[model samples]
Target: MKVCLVGSSGGHLTHLYMLKPFWKEKDRFWVTFEKEDARSLLEGEKMYPCYFPTNRNIKNLIRNTFVAWKVLRKEKPDLIISSGAAVSVPFFYLGKLLGAKLIYIEVFDRIDKPTLSGKMVYPIVDKFIVQWEEEKKVYPKAVNLGSIF
Candidate 1:
């Protein structure tokens, strides 16, 4: 299966990277910030840089929406996954419309409250995974997969 892994550069990126066992053999690519950590971590992987400072930033959100359209159209991944801050929004929404399955893993740090991006994509995601059992209270349908780390 083709997968599109999308997340922010730091903790979010690390979160997704921890799932390497699951994605290692798949035809996959990444969509993340063009930052040092991301660049270093994804060394030889196929990656597409998206606009950043996405939290509450209308300009970047709009720009990322276009980027999302372009990338999703070109890649046509069968699944899209993310543990996010903000960068996942455009990609998830657009990917869903393109008929890709979506999975959103709420950051491990958040136990009770829902993140902005998590809340935005919750209704549309095919699976909502939570690292902590308590998180299930926030995202009622989230599957408690313990922690990726």
Candidate 2:
């Protein structure tokens, strides 16, 4: 199946990368910041840069919404997965409207409380995966998948 993997740079990007076992054989592309690390790690892979400084930034959020619209329209991925900071919001919301199955992996570090991105997408995601069992208390419907780390 075609897949779109979206996440913020750094740790969030690393979290998604660690899922290579699942995505390695699939047709996939990445959505993330155009930072040096992301550039180096995603070399020879298809990637679309999203607007950043996305934490509580209204302007970038609006810009990323447009980016999401354009990319999702073009890729038409059957699945969209993320372990996020903020950039996952626009893509998850728009991808759902377009009928893509969504999976949101709550970051491994968050053992108790929900991350902002997790809270935003939980209600709509096809599967909400939590790294720690404790997180299930915060996200009642979340599946306890242990650590993706």
Candidate 3:
């Protein structure tokens, strides 16, 4: 399957990278920030860098959305999976609109409260996975996948 892995930099990217074993062999590419960690970890891999200042930044969000539209149109991934921050928002909607299955993994750190990205994409995703069981209270439809760490 053609897969598009989307996530922000730092911890969000780290958590998604843990699932490398799952996507490494598949036809996959990444949508993430161009950070040192992302650069090092994704060396030689196909990736589409996202814009910065994502959280609540309307300017960047609009720019990122345009970028996402282009990428999703060109890649035509069969599935789009994300452990997100802010960059995944545009990709999720565009990917879904293009008929790609959407899977969202809530960040492992947010146990008590739901993340904004998670909540925003929750109702639209095909699958909502949570690392912690307690997260289910916030995202009732989320499946407890017992941590991606």
Candidate 4:
């Protein structure tokens, strides 16, 4: 099935890269901010660049929304799997509205705690995959699928 992996750099991208090989046999794409990390790991697939967030705060959400609007209209993948930051937020909303299955993998960083985005998107996700079992305490509905990597 066609899939889009949406996430930021650093840990999020690191984790998603681990699952890249599996998606290669099918139509797969990656969406990220302005960063070379995804480019270095992925080859010959579609990619969308969301405006990089400078503060890692709400301000970037607006910019990402615009980027998401463009991507969803073009790619319109059957499913969206994200190990996220700001970029995935817009995609999640768009995916839900567009009737696409949205699977969100809470980043591996919050091994002991949870992130703001994780908390917000937890209940909305069609399938919430968490790297750590402890994450389920915060989001009881999440499936503690041992890391995709």
The predictions' CA RMSDs to the true structure, in order, are 0.5, 0.5, 0.8, 1.7
lDDT computed for candidate 4: 0.78
Candidates' C-alpha lDDT: 0.95, 0.96, 0.92, 0.78
User: Candidate 3 on 1-149: residue-level lDDT in tens?
Assistant: 99999988888888888998998899999989888989998999999998997999999999999999999999999999999988999999988999999999998889979888998999899999998989989999889989787
- Candidate 1 structure quality by residue, lDDT tens digits, 43-101: 99999999888999999999999999999999999999999979899999999999999
- Quick one: RMSD of model 2? 0.5
lDDT of 3: 0.92
TM-score result, candidate 3 = 0.97
Clashing pairs in 3: none
Native-to-model Cα distance after best TM-score fit, residue 104 in candidate 2, in Å: 0.1
lDDT of 2: 0.96
Better-scoring candidate (TM-score), 2 or 4: 2
Task: Give the lDDT ranking, best first.
Answer: 2, 1, 3, 4
Off by over 4 Å in 3: none
Candidate 2 per-residue lDDT over residues 1-149, each given as its tens digit: 99999999999999999999999999999999999999999999999999989999999999999999999999999999999979999999999999999999999989989999999999999999998889989999999988877
Task: List residue ranges in candidate 2 displaced over 4 A.
Answer: none
Instruction: Write candidate 4's Cα lDDT for 32-136 as tens digits.
Output: 765776677665667776777623666778878877888888888889887777678788888888878988888776876777777667767899988889988
Clash number for every model?
0, 0, 0, 0
